[model samples]
Target: MPGFYYPIYFFQLDAIKHGVSVTFSFYSLVILNASNFVGRVTSGYIAVFVGVINLTIVATISCSVLNFGMIGLNSLVSVVVLGVFYGYLSGVYAALVAPLITTLTPDLSELGARMGITAFFVGGIGVLIGAPISGALLTSKYIWWIPAVFSGTISLTGGMVYIIMRSMFIRHQFKSQA
Candidate 1:
């Protein structure tokens, strides 16, 4: 798929005649993989104190900015910058998953049960679908009507949902206290 898609996107810009096939590809993947590993390890160690929303908000914002910028990249330098930023951001994203769920449910034993049911059925689909659908979108330049547009839109929507739900929960908490 990268082989098929890279050429088209490569041709679209003057910086990469063949896109980032050789050195940059490996470098990009390494950066992303290393960051993901670090994020997960750190999240595992220090998740007791930080709120899940805060960590995930950082990840989502980073991704939103990078993904949006990736769409706008026109030069080799921009591509490299995009890769580094995206890798680090996605790394943070990997770190936030467990805390996000654990905090949402917040019962040690019960967290297991809740995450199991939700992760496999609901969250699994997002991971499954986000890529293929975005890949299908060959045109997202002007109107952002393709996969990238949809991905960013979903991220924004998720943020909105979090805010609304958090507000409702807070209101409930206040009323209960009252």
Candidate 2:
């Protein structure tokens, strides 16, 4: 999520730098937000059928994969398309976080405490470092793709971590049942 935030924070500037039309540059954000709105609403319905953790994993992977497309393209059409997909998947990811956390915890009584601690640590650290690292990449100008690649890789890594966590959770559940 932090990885994706880089673009949400800096995309307008990036668009201007890349010579994209001003109108399209603005539309890029609009398209992303609109799609995100749709995704958030739809995810609630999907979560009921698919389960929150499952949906979150799918959404995370989708965002991770699409991040590569966003990083590699500069055309307005590509940006618009990728932006919308990324926005939607990201929205799903955001919507599912709390539910996913709830699913992982052992005690419903501890849910609030667990969520608060997780939010404080994870959100705090991500907010502190994500943008500055991305900005540093941009300022270095070692390569244009560095920031995008960095963001994409981070998102991909996050998805992989979630996969591992899910597997461990399942294993624990089975062991407890036995």
Candidate 3:
């Protein structure tokens, strides 16, 4: 979320920097958000088949890849495409996050407390600091790609963590069965 959030918060400025009309810049966000809505709605069914962890890992990694694609785009069409793609992938992560948490919890009794802690860390601290860091990277020159790379690296790191957690979960499962 830090990855997606920072880029989204600065998207308008980036678009305007590229000479895209202000109105269209705003519309780019709308397009992204609307696509996000669609992705959230569809993700449930997709997760049913793909499994929450697998789908989340795929979406997070895909988002990282797409953020790298944001580096050199100079057209509104390209921006719009990036918004739609990134939005959908990020939305998938959003939708599945709670379920992912559920899987991580060993006891249902601890779920609510764990969820709150997770939200505080991810949404509160991580997101709060990430945008400013990205903004700081922008400087007066508005070097958009630098921030894009930063965001991509964050997402990639998150994807790697998820991969590690998944492996640990599998190992635990196998041990319990044995």
lDDT of each: 0.56, 0.79, 0.86
Using lDDT as the measure, which candidate wins? 3
| Residue 136 CA displacement from its true place in model 1, Å | 1.2
lDDT of 3 by residue, 61-127 (tens): 9988987887866788888898898889888988988999998898999999989989656567878
Candidate 1, residues 4-54, lDDT tens digits: the string is: 122123223322333655555545555555665766666645545555676
Could you report the Cα RMSD, in angstroms, for every candidate shown?
5.5, 1.7, 1.2
lDDT of 2 at 148: 74
Residue 108 in candidate 2, Cα distance off native in Å:
1.3
Report the Cα lDDT for residue 37, model 2.
85
Clash pairs detected, candidate 3: none
lDDT of 2 by residue, 46-109 (tens): 9999988778889977876775665665777777887788788878887788888899989999
Pairs that collide in candidate 2 are: none
